[model samples]
Target: MTAWGVVRTAFGDHDVPSTLMGVTVLGYDGQLVEIEATAAVLDS
Candidate 1:
């Protein structure tokens, strides 16, 4: 599975940078799963 998301703070600052993430589930067992993620920041 794969997913994407954005993280934001509640400070209400327009200039606040944006954090974007991409995640993927590479492998899974009955009780464990491996995950990989990458993140980037964009200036606002």
Candidate 2:
């Protein structure tokens, strides 16, 4: 899936967990595993 596609899926499925200032997912994996967001950073 494209980057935006992942973003959309994450947001739609509430995978983000909380309101995030930003999100960045990397690595080439067949299955979805890790999701990193800037929500905590933004809370600073």
Candidate 3:
């Protein structure tokens, strides 16, 4: 499964249905991944 973390409130695009937020993802070899998450699964 893809790991996710460091969720925080951020600017959201009006086109999206749910609230938008920022998140950090961890990768192997000290690499980091970032993505925009919707309020639908912020805690799931």
The candidate that wins on TM-score is 2
lDDT of 3 by residue, 1-44 (tens): 22222222243333434444454655556776556654554664
Q: Which ten residues in a row have the lowest lDDT in candidate 3?
A: 1-10
Whole-model lDDT per candidate? 0.45, 0.59, 0.43
TM-scores for all candidates: the values are 0.27, 0.31, 0.20
Candidate 2, residues 2-29: lDDT per residue as tens digits? 6667788767955554443443754665
Clashes of each: 0, 0, 0
The list of candidate 1 runs beyond 4 A from truth reads 1-30
Over 4 Å off, model 2: 13-37, 40-44
The candidate maximizing lDDT is 2
Q: Which ten residues in a row have the lowest lDDT in candidate 1?
A: 1-10
Candidate 1: clashing pairs of residues: none
Model 1 reaches what TM-score against the true structure?
Answer: 0.27
lDDT of 3 at 5: 21
Model 2 C-alpha lDDT versus the unseen true structure: 0.59
Candidate 3 Cα outliers beyond 4 Å, as residue runs: 1-28, 39-44
